[model samples]
Target: LWGVELDPTSTDPRIPVVLSKFLRANPGDFKAAETSLRSILVWRANFDIPTLLTSEDFPEELGENIGVIRPKDVKGRPVVYHQYSGVDHKAAFGDLDRFVRWRVQLMELSMLQCDFLHADSLLMIHDYAGVSIFSYDRYAKAASKKTISILQDNYPECLAVKLFIHIPWWGTSIYKLVSRWIPEATRKKISIVSTAETLSVLLTYIKEDDLPKIYQ
Candidate 1:
């Protein structure tokens, strides 16, 4: 079924794990997984599936309902863009390791789905995942590179991307896991924020300033 982390700060994005288990239990039937995931994506995108699935004449046939979502009554205001910063919930660092692995898995899926690549924007919410992949031991480096390639290829337009990485995963330390996946040209486009101070710097819309120290 579809899955989302109710607690953003949760260390594990367990939905992937559950999905994997289900896949193992029932081989080759991906329709259920896709349906569930697509439903979740529709919800996340704020699309009213019920309305799309129903009309006044077919009300009884509808399994859900849709209603007008009133617009916020703000008269003429600019919407400020905020960078993606994983999750805001407070949680232990170790707990996030599982999510890091799952993030890699999702990046791989983007290769087939291609929506993440074509979207107007892409927000990758990662706690320690982005950075931690760098430290996935030498054995997993090849697999990690493959995943990173998919991510690099699928970046959305406007190059609008945000990452929240922690600890030793920042800077050149991360090169090993993903360097091969991204071309030198594309690598120059990724901006990283590994510290609170760096986030403040991003808020100010400043670039080339001193970056914050990585936090584990």
Candidate 2:
């Protein structure tokens, strides 16, 4: 799809194996198999897999606050957890664009790390604890909008679930306002949990050890 041959033998061994499994499972769905393979190839090209793995552009200063932890299997899919709080956001991401780029890199890295598990999607956990009026300032909002756009536009159909936890009452209003920009299909994947019990209930898909200590 991206000037790269899709031959399984000549390229990555996993590529052909995954496609073959998909075709076998579908049985008489060649179009669907081709579309799925094309999407994977396109994602690999646009994500620039080699560059991301070798590049030192994204420094530790930019990504220290964010983490790509162990994957938790949910509904037979490997779910990667991305934990972030308002404090971490303010501390690490001073420049919006830099933060966005770093975030994208982190996602790409996570995808590669979990590729062996055959995970096609990810689950995000956004811990909004300690968020206040200051968090919704002009710069923060603008940055957030841009970040959302990048995720929704560039990485399509990759989010299996998104959990917004510890949302304050004031934050809820701001969230509703910002959420208008998100597509309905994507928005449906988000679940806002205010109470610890509720968040726990939602996180039942993941194992206790896999979850962050704060959530536990």
Candidate 3:
């Protein structure tokens, strides 16, 4: 575990307030709240977020069809778009470890952009139109699990909503299995739209011009 310290005077004032609220909401679960807050701090340090923002590794990821869009959502949250079809786990990344590292770097970059908008959360759109089971092979599956774990455990309240569009029937079963790994609160924010028409639901949170052509 990364070293975690609670320095009141040097820390963000809002953090303590959030921590207090978490403890209050959880009642006698002070230990759980403290642990959760500590993990957030540890992730901040261990993620090497500042280095990722300036690192050249980011351009490769962005060029590979992973990026944070310029427009903020209706609520001012940043939007992170992923083209699942564009990703070739073995051919593009070579191995699971490398793939996961690239994913973590990309996530850090997106989170950095979110910070500039004074947003703690982000809206994610994963386009699975052309993706197939081949894309979800063992390597990709392992990486996806790790990615979800990082997001759910370390990132803490950073996901505002997720729109999974163009999912096939086979993909639904995979999503059902994955849903079990996600927290209920986060699961509630996830929507799986089977057709392009149902994508209108996203317009409520994202503007038409802001959406990519495929979703529009």
Question: Would you list the clashing residue pairs of candidate 1?
Answer: 11-95, 11-96, 167-215
The candidate that achieves the highest lDDT relative to the unseen native structure: 3
Q: Rate the local accuracy (lDDT) of all candidates.
A: 0.35, 0.64, 0.68
| Count of backbone clashes, every candidate in sequence | 3, 0, 0
**What local lDDT does model 3 show for residue 29?**
86
Using alpha carbons, what is the TM-score of model 2? 0.71
lDDT accuracy of residue 146 in candidate 1: 45
User: Candidate 1, residues 43-144: lDDT per residue as tens digits?
Assistant: 434533233323312221111111111111122111112222332222212333332333333332322222221232233322343334334444345444
Which parts of model 2 have CA positions greater than 4 angstroms off? Answer: 1-5, 8-49, 57-61, 76-91, 116-118
For residues 1-216, write the lDDT of model 2, one tens digit per residue. 212245746766555544554475346989876676566667667767567557748666565345554556555454555444534445456677677767777676555444533555677777667666666666667767887877765555667787777777776788798998898878888888885554465567787776656666
Q: Which stretches of candidate 1 lie over 4 Å from their true place?
A: 1-119, 129-135, 153-159, 162-164, 167-171, 196-198, 201-216
The total number of steric clashes, by the backbone 3 Å criterion, in model 3 comes to 0
* Model 3, CA-based lDDT: 0.68
Per-residue alpha-carbon lDDT of model 3 for 99-162, expressed as tens digits? 6666666666565565422555678887788888667876667767877887777666667789
Flag the better candidate by TM-score, 1 or 3.
3
